[model samples]
Target: DAGVTQSPTHLIKTRGQQVTLRCSPISGHKSVSWYQQVLGQGPQFIFQYYEKEERGRGNFPDRFSARQFPNYSSELNVNALLLGDSALYLCASRATGTNEKLFFGSGTQLSVL
Candidate 1:
């Protein structure tokens, strides 16, 4: 089966503009998730949804929001973009069960001007 996939691999936006990124999980995965990687930092947890319900969220500001569809795919929305928000927005997914490994997508690169 295909791995996770994200759309519009690259995008550019100015400060104060809003952006929406989309993701599709691997087949049969019941959870959709998020993480972000800054310049030199490791992936930081952001948000997650399982069984189509939000399961967790990171310390990001209210400008960030997301939702999981009934099919387990997800959409991430950012309001009032900021240069600091420019990073590789990663999508992740996991099968439900103990010891299941999380799978990550290549990520959508968002550049804020």
Candidate 2:
């Protein structure tokens, strides 16, 4: 069985542009969450979806959004990217909700110029 995976290990973009990052959850997992980690900072939750329905969300701006698919994959979309948006976008998945152990992918490192 494969663990969580993310695409485009690194990304570079300019301000005012948009970017989309992808994630695939572990087998048999139905919940996928998106997080952002700034340089030297801890990961902050962005959004979480379970069974294709949004289960939880964090203190993120409208520019950040995500959705889970029926196959348990997910995508994180950021609109109107800013230089401050440069960070590592991490994807985490859990077999179940509440206190479940989360598995994370290395993440897509986004750089805004």
Candidate 3:
């Protein structure tokens, strides 16, 4: 399925804009991946899933893991979380294989406090 792209393109725009628009993607995919992006750095690989099965694992420690449900929704768990674990957690899903196209989530901020 084709995901929704931003309007006004954010590439070209007029002076004043008063239009309220919503942009999102259609869910449900075969593979999913999790990432962690620290401040002033790129995203670091965390976990990977393919049809509720783990296909690949990143260089992260055993403290990180993920579980995929029947509905394709996934949960990422960090055992004995530490202060360094506080960062932006992102998720990406792919319709085809794990290494194919990937649609990334906006990510959520995780705090140790």
Candidate 4:
């Protein structure tokens, strides 16, 4: 089964443009989460969705949003992007059980010029 998949692999946008990144979870997984990783820092949790319901959100501003589909695929959207928002947007997924290990995708590299 696949671990996780993210689309567009890379993106380039202006400071005020908006962008959307997509992800597909592994088979038998019901939980999907998003994270942002700056070049030299650990990934920061952005949002998490389980069973198509919002479960958690991080300290990111309102410009960030996400949604999970019935099939467990998800999308992360960012509005009014800023240069500071440039980073690797990662998608992670885990089985529906306690202590399940998370699996991550290669991520979408967003560059705000």
List the candidates' TM-scores in order.
0.96, 0.95, 0.72, 0.97
> Sort by lDDT, best first: what order?
4, 2, 1, 3
Error of 3 at 23 (Å): 17
TM-score: model 2 vs. ground truth: 0.95
> What lDDT tens digits, residue by residue, belong to model 4 across residues 1-113?
66799998999999999999999999888999999999999999999999999999999999999999999999999999999999999999988875967899999999999
Clashing residue pairs in candidate 4 are none
7: Cα error in model 2, Å: 0.5
TM-score of 1: 0.96
Candidate of highest lDDT = 4
Cα lDDT tens digits, model 3, 1-113, are 55522222222122232122112333657676877889999999887877789988889987677777776667776666667776777777777734576687666666564
Give the true-structure RMSD of model 2: 1.2
Which window of ten consecutive residues has the lowest lDDT sum in model 1?
A: 93-102
Q: lDDT of each model, Cα atoms only?
A: 0.92, 0.93, 0.63, 0.95
How many clashing residue pairs, candidate 1? 0
For model 3, the stretches where C-alpha displacement exceeds 4 angstroms are: 1-26, 97-99
Residue 23 of model 4: what lDDT?
Answer: 98
User: Highest TM-score: which candidate?
Assistant: 4
